[model samples]
Target: MRNLQGRLELCSINTATLGHREPLNQTIERIARAGFGGIAPWRREVEGGDVPRLARQIKALGLSVTGYCRSTYLPAATSAEFSANVEANRAALRDAAVLGAQCFVLVVGGLVPGSRDLEGARSQVVDGISMLLETARECGVPLALEPLHPMYAAKRAVVNTIAQALSICETVDPDRSGFIGIAVDVYHCWWDPELTASIATTGQANRILAYHVCDWLHETNDMLLDRGMMGDGVIDLPAVRSCVERAGYNGLVEVEIFSAQNWWQREPDEVLAICAERLQTVC
Candidate 1:
């Protein structure tokens, strides 16, 4: 079965690519019609207007949830800011449970402005995740710590490497617990010298919770939102896929793009069509 392309359960779409145009219900229908196995939606989409209603819509469309977009942004300068972030995560976690999402992706917070203490931010992240892991486990939702690229180390996430994410998980959960894991996205880790080894280690520990796919533009125009389409960029996606598969991660390969200028301007159906084509050819 090595030549069988593994399984067709590999295709998923992140709803953000279509956020500029489609409603959540319409997007789900479109994605489902495109033969995708699952979709990962952002909290903004989930809370756009209604949540329970949207959850029902997702189930009716017969689409699986790869994972929730995010829940953690724990590094804050003040107690009030920290508490607010915690509350947001609690709400997001509940939403994940309601939608039967596979995991609640966590972008552990980065350095606050004017603060250079990387270690401090990471400690806060660990604390926040530790505090929420219990509630996550109780709700039957997994928390997938997403290690963002170093480019975002100062503003989005301090956990910038797979090794760092796994270390935090190991420390917070210690016993290689089931609910806390990592979300590996190609765009974030393609340049990592330790990616392959980290994937192997994560797999052996059974901490590979979610897998996201996207191409990283060589001439990255925008640091935050300019993600390229699969084959349009330079990432060796299939090679990454090989690593993930070898590591025993057979979960959906969710496609997450934040192309503010490219994809977000296309028709939702057109985006889905392209995604379908790319899923076969590029991803």
Candidate 2:
């Protein structure tokens, strides 16, 4: 296992950790100054900007973009909507490629509103991903499918487990072409009894594309906005990292927290400082 102790070079900051409180340019500067090795920016921050120029800026600052924020929702209520969503995802893929991102993260969406067809939604997700695979390959941008927590199954993502995510990859890219894989976030997956085993499976298949870190608050206030810092919550973060490293995942450790009531309210620099400190000691 890699020793992350006192190694800030292994740390990557997902821009959301600063709560989107700062502009993309400032966020890049602060993150670089904070001595992190990489940064992952969201779609909101990338759209309407000069993408190539921004990519140059990030490269100039010596920070690698670990992954692009996300793709458009895959499961839609109508055929037209699904087609449009797929087009949008293609656009995201192009942007990710232009930005020199390691991969384009896919938050494969949940059921259509007021719909009870869970199986249908899952099928749409699979088909949607299949449609995008060729484009992903053409652009040379890998796809990282992120399975959200089961609590988000109704609204955020139907892909709610690492095993489920890997299954999609296996079905779509049976050869393990490395164009499709999974992004494991601790906040959404820490409760799983099979997490360690799943990580091993993912590693063996060479499908672990990204690894995210954040703690699950025991007394959570809101499902979407109450994430805790690395050591401030209930997750055994170091142990989780051990499982990932032992499974052969030698990638950046991305810190992606969405604490609207807490971390977002603080100064961005302070947040970056705290992330560096926590990553070295506790993660």
Candidate 3:
């Protein structure tokens, strides 16, 4: 496994860790100044803004866009809604290209709006990715299927395991042209019994796109928030990273925490400093 050893350049920060408290440009600046090598910005952060200029700015600061945070929900209630969602994802891919992102992260949506068809929603997800593969290929941005934890299966994502994401990749991009892959977020995947084997399979296929880190609090009060910082929760992060490394994933180790009551309340600089510190130590 790669050692961070105080090497901030080997790490990235998803802006949500700071709760989206500042403008995206300012956040990018702060992240670069803090010595992180990359930033993963939410799409909402770029809406109605100067994308090309911002991309240039991020480049000038020497920070790469690790991945664009997330695709629009694929399993909507209506055909028009699903088409619109696909279009939105296409737009996101275009922007990711302009920003020179390494990959465009896909948080495939769960059960369709107002329905209980789990398998149906998953079908939509696969179809949506198939529809977007051409755009992703054209834009030169890989579609990274980030499987949210199963708890999010009802709303956020239907693909909740590395194996599931990999299966989707094989189905959509069987030749593995690098247009589709998986983002392994520890918070979501740490509990899978097939974690190691599934990840190893992904590695053999070269489908691991990004690796996210955040501790799952033992008695979390909120599902969305309450993410523990490195070493604060019970997850053995090092073990997860080892599995990821053994899978041949050599990308930035991204820190993605949603601590509404704790880290979000602190100064962004403080939060960043701690992230860097923990990346060198606990994580």
Candidate 4:
């Protein structure tokens, strides 16, 4: 595994870690001054400011767009809703292109509203991705499908495993043209029994697009907002990083935490400093 002792250049922070309490422009400046190499800003954060100016500012500050946070959920109750969601994704992809992002992340949403058929929802996900590949390919932005934890299987994401995300890729980008891939997040995937082998397989296919770090707390109060920092929870983060590196993913290792009660309630700079410190020492 690679030693990241002083390599802040290899680290990135998903702006959501700052709790979205501030505008992205200021957030960008603080993150750059904090010595991170990249920032993954969410769509809402980007929309609050001018993309053209934001793009210029980020470039001037010398930060890579690790990724555009996500695609709108692909599954919906009706054909029209699904089509609208696709158009929204196309627009998001265009914005991602404007930022020169490394990839456009996809959360491949859960079962459609008012439905319980998991297989049907997965179909919508595959078809939605197939349709969006045109825009993604045109923009030259790879789509990084992110599988949420199984608990999110009903409301956030139906694709709950790396294997499932890879299966979607097989159906959509069979040629491996680099247009489709998976975004691995420890919070969502640490429970998978086949993660190490899946990471190896993802490397063999060159489909691992992003690696996210956050710990899963054992006694979580809220599943969506209770993620822990590195070394604060039960996850074996260093071991996971080794597997990811061995699988050939040498890109930025992003920190994405959603701690509503703890970190989010603290000062942003302190969070960023802790993130940098943890990435270097623990992660």
Candidate 5:
């Protein structure tokens, strides 16, 4: 809705896109130089030292925060493991707050080893989210439930649909007080038959937290990496963004790629330039 003319003020860069080529701070500076609206960083980049200082750096560079990289890896065999994840998430949330992030993205973990309890894994997800919501609310930062692709269901996320994530949002924070929502990453949802409907539903409920961009490669080299660039792949991004727009989301379209082979090997500035160009022409 913000860019009805196809002018992209919503373009952002996830630092992982250039993770292999540069350090986090340099990536942030490069992203700012490339003219993206925001950056979403992984937790490791901020954990070692002064997060507020890094926050100041990001702010001074005139870039905004889309969300923090990740939080939820809750599924564990032992109660101690679950509690440890909760504490880790809480600490991640605090870092997000310090970075002045709008939301903290949650990549709910997969099943415990040797376990076939999909339902139990989901239960752990729900419980973990419920526990974290209060801290998220207190910090005035939202918790973004990223429904990873079904390909990741075995070891990444139990909630693999926009419908499922929204259901959690309703159950945990029904008011949609902007405290709970979904991160709609196009790479994960473009293949879904129910995606458009889900986006519309998310819009009506105001549960769309952050929108991420990346192309899904056709060859499918690796399950965890091997993402495609915007125009290089088959995704109709503008159409997807339109669905997100229709769903009442006016957030940054954060470009997140885990391409171990392609984008990561390129120079950081070159990658940013391509991301910007692709955003304008194709996205």
Candidate 6:
């Protein structure tokens, strides 16, 4: 395991941690100034123009682009909608390549609207990902499938476990070509009894594309927004980190917190500082 003690270079910041209060350019500057080794920006923030220029800016600041924010939702009610969603994801992959991001994250969609067909939604997600794999390979941008917590299985993501994500990867890239893999987020996965084994399997397969860290509040107010800072919640951060390291993951550890009421209310600089401090001590 890489010792992060006093080594902020292993740390990366996902811009959402800043609550979208600053512009993308300013966010990049602040993250770089805050001494983060990398930054992950959302698609919404990078959709405007001159993406290559933006990439250059990030590089000029001596920071890496850890990963692109996300791909479009894969499951839809209609064939046309699903095709469009796939195309949108293709575009995001292209953008990720231009930005020199390590990989493009995918938050696979859940049950189609007005439908309880969970199996059908999972099928659509598989097809969507299979369709995008060639483009991702062509662009030299890997795809990271992020399995959200089961709590979001109904609306956000149907791929609710690391095992499930790996299943999809196996189906799509049986050769383990590394074109598609899984993004392990502790906030969504800490409660799983199989986390350690699952991470070990992912490591053996060499499919751990990205690693995200944040705390799960014990008394959560909002399922979507209330995330606690590291050391302020019940998750065993060092244990989780140990799992990833034992699994042979050596990538940047991204700090992604979506706290609408707490961290978001504070200044971005302060949040960055605390993240750095907590990462060194607790994480």
Query: In terms of lDDT, which candidate is stronger, 1 or 6?
Result: 6
TM-score of candidate 6 against the unseen true structure: 0.99
lDDT by residue (88-183, candidate 6, tens digit) is 999989999999999999999878989999999999999999999999999999999999999999989999999999999999999998889999
lDDT of 5 by residue, 1-283 (tens): 4552344456788888886455677878888877777999998777887788889999998888999989859999999999999999998998999999999999999888799999999999999999999999888889999998898999889889899899999999877788999999998899899999999998899888899988977786988789998878889988999889888888788999988887788888788888888888778
Clashes of each: 0, 0, 0, 0, 1, 0
Task: State the TM-score for model 2.
Answer: 0.99
lDDT string, candidate 2, 181-225, tens digits: 989899989999999999999999999889999899889899999
Total backbone clashes of candidate 1, pairs 3 or more residues apart or in separate chains = 0
| Structural similarity to truth (TM-score) of each candidate | 0.95, 0.99, 0.98, 0.98, 0.96, 0.99
Please give, for residues 26-133, the per-residue lDDT of candidate 3 as tens digits. 999999999999999988898689999999999999998999988999998888999999999999999999989999999988897689999989999999999999
Off by over 4 Å in 2: none
Residue pairs with colliding backbones in model 3 are: none
- Runs in model 1 deviating more than 4 A are 1-9
Clashing pairs in 2: none
The superposed Cα distance between candidate 5 and the true structure at residue 122, in angstroms, equals 0.3
Give me the runs in candidate 3 sitting further than 4 Å from their true place. none
lDDT of 1 by residue, 97-160 (tens): 9989999999887798799999888888888998999989898999999999998898899999
Error of 3 at 32 (Å): 1.0
Over all chains combined, what TM-score does candidate 5 have?
A: 0.96
